[model samples]
Target: MRFDISGHYLLLQAFDRTGRKVFGGEWHGDEAFARDTEDPSGVSGERRNIQDLIKTLAASAEPHNAILASDADEEEHQAASDALHQINRELGQLKERLATLPHVTGSWLADHEAFKRRTDIESKLFEAFRSGDLDLQVGPNEIVQWRTWSRQPDFKVLFSMSCVIVPRSHAGQRRRGPAFIQLAAFEKWLCRFAGAATGTEELTPEAQLEIWLREKIKGPKEFSKPVYRAHALEEIPELSARAFDRVWDNVVPKNWKRRGRHGS
Candidate 1:
């Protein structure tokens, strides 16, 4: 859209499917003159047309220049929109991965205190371990605690993760558990190391974790089916009992149920 002030009046112009003048009149900076120039099809509204026209005129000295400037502005806007969409897409993927991580709770960054604490942990971990100097090991079971020194400060860390196997329902059913527990833990460690080494705090913990998981770990060679549904039960306190109850219902021996139904 473009406009020019000539002979003490404003001339409005814009492009459409045909770029033809749908309506033409004199606007006196009042409501009635506005009504006179309004096109019911709304190829352009008075206020927006005027604003766009002003912008167009400010960009260049000639009407032809204004058209070129408007086209450039539109192209720039489209480029920005595409970039924003890409960022949002990547963010959604990060959130989904973060959701799969064990011990993740609440809407990401919703709780101020919890967010700060998590980020602090991420920062500390990144600082202590990014160099790959500290000795690290994983065991088959039971939580572990270790002490590490970095940044002229000592941090004591206690952390554990394991897959809770869900056995098959029938006689020949296979066992299953959530798949990403190990991956999540690995990513978490990498993100903390990144925070410490680079002093980058803007990226979400999840995004940082993803970068390290992909680049440093190169992912696990074997992929497993993830039991994502089980996480919902764990997240809501009211539903936690249901998870255990369902497991007992399925896994407890038939004789145990019969025995309980009858007597001690």
Candidate 2:
């Protein structure tokens, strides 16, 4: 599970015990969630750290119990008891800290249902664009506009469409243009839409690499970037070294340790 918060938007994704994705939701807020912090990246890192700690604590009980049940010396027993006590203390603190954060209240759909709804909306938008029924026209600074077929614009469709189609930097500009979108943004969105309709978006470089890493690497494994790159290329011939470097750290599991001279 992960909660990715940025400005007024939050994306939450969750997986079941078998690691199958069960829920995915995107939320929009009237006010920013991280107004007190200037560093969004830092907030993301902190969230991940908290999640890691939760996982670690959840798995620690058996090991600590084993030590207590064994014929260990007094010192060892004392250490295990102290560790369990510390874990409890941390868990209590975590609960209190989490309670202080602003609660998100909204409706959501299951993963499959959400995907179907999104695909249906994108297909309609794509068909409109392809049929030239949208009546696209060039606006200022490479922006594209279309005439609304109905008396009022279909804001719901436009809102859903823009979430996946519009670039984050140009989102504000879109609000100003109202009826406009960036032509520069169209190609990427078009490709994404086509891929979704055809079920090929999962084959993208980023998606492929994420799948590879999760399958090949496991807990406590030493991650050597050079070695991983070589293996990844063998598995995915199209993997770009520069692109891999750019996202390697972000995609790697939190518990993975760097090996050799870079190990920490």
Candidate 3:
């Protein structure tokens, strides 16, 4: 992926149990990401080794003007763009594939004591959070995540988490997963969408974490309510090795991997 990995930005996010932003900043480096050779799945990783560990992160760690000589030419630049496109496509496919699992709300979880979902809102809690109805807030940059809240062009919320987490299950065979939306963005986007008079009071990272923990423990129905089913990508059947090969073969140009095709 390095073929096109250069020059692009990444918004790597991290939050504690209470969904508070302990640290947040942009990460910029050609060598930012270390290799994860052991990860069976090609999705999220366990931790970051100090390249820049914080609560919020953007696509490129370095600002644009700062990368003058280091930036690639037009063709090389396109390759990076293409790489991002491919990564995003994989993320999309995985998200879709995981939509059929038992999940809970709160992008981050604390209590493992399972509960049941309620029909109070006439919809699931996750849907509500994503609907901008809750008007959530996360992190410093205030990236919001939702379709209805898409009106704000500068809003940087993640609509759904492309990654999957498989927890130690006591509930059943079904894998547990949930979509995530960052704090600052989620709140800001909701305010924009709902046209709220006053934006939310900025809370310290500790306070923010408490808010998120309260919400998670409270469950989907504003507290203590639970949502049983959710989008669980890990449970989705992985593409057969052969299928992956075939897709790659079709996607890669014939000559890209051809050496002995002409009886050389």
Candidate 4:
């Protein structure tokens, strides 16, 4: 009888004195039975004998030693062992070469740390902006400096100002309103600014009216002064009603239609 272990089961084959297969089966869990015999019912005796052999093998001190394999199995096992040994030797050589290389340290490490710090600060800055703790306004000079430094010829500084600073002809066009700077664009600009700004510099309010005006312009073509005042109060709590009106009168287009008026 020879036993071959294949995955989770054990295959058993018994040969007669003439080297002809007398019984063959597979053992699973606690059961053993003849599977390929000519007359399975008649081979009940053979099955019992095989089961007894399996039990004896299981009870052996080293159950693995009880398994039987042909010469081909031994050769395959030797080949696999040699491959594993070769892999280990190659890994050892790689480790030796890596150890001989210089240790990595210096400017690159400092640059990485600086990048991480900038990321963390930028995240906090954006969070503050979203939560209304920080305003979008910055000085005109600062905006100009950033615009020049960015080297983006198409960068619109009007979107960042407190008023629609474009020519009256451009302002009349619907596309060039403060609404042109969507929240996403504004946040992107903020992120870029955060990256370039020194950690010690403080941001100032420069575009509160422009921000409010943009939102209102996006909604209705006609709105009342009281409605505008109410929105200003809600959106720009830091600015007084008088200050809001002053900025509104100065920046609002003269030809803008009111709720009751047909023309400017």
The best candidate by TM-score is 4
**Per-model CA lDDT versus the true structure:** 0.31, 0.45, 0.30, 0.37
What C-alpha lDDT does candidate 1 achieve relative to the native structure?
0.31
| Candidate 4 lDDT score relative to the true structure | 0.37
Quote the lDDT for 189 in model 2.
37
| Candidate that would win on lDDT | 2
Judge candidate 3 at residue 208 and give its lDDT.
Answer: 35
Ranking according to TM-score, highest score first: 4, 2, 3, 1
User: Which wins on lDDT, candidate 1 or candidate 4?
Assistant: 4
- Model 2: residue 45 alpha-carbon error in angstroms: 59
Total clashes, candidate 3? 31
What tens digits encode model 4's per-residue C-alpha lDDT throughout 146-200? 3232244333322112222333332333322221212322432344332223210
Higher-lDDT candidate among 3 and 4?
4
For every candidate in turn, the CA RMSD to the true structure comes to 31.2, 25.3, 33.3, 30.7
Poorest 10 consecutive residues by lDDT, candidate 3 = 113-122
Better of 2 and 4 by TM-score: 4
lDDT of candidate model 2 versus the reference: 0.45
- lDDT per residue, candidate 1, 182-263, as tens digits? 2323333443322223221333333332333234224322221122224323333343434434433432334333333221
Model 3 per-residue lDDT tens digits across residues 1-264: 111111111222211111122111211111112221222222223122111232222244233323333566877556656655664565555455445332433421212111111111113324545655443333222223445444444333332232222333321353322324344334433343222132233433322332333343333222111111111112223323333333333323343334442212
TM-score of 2: 0.27
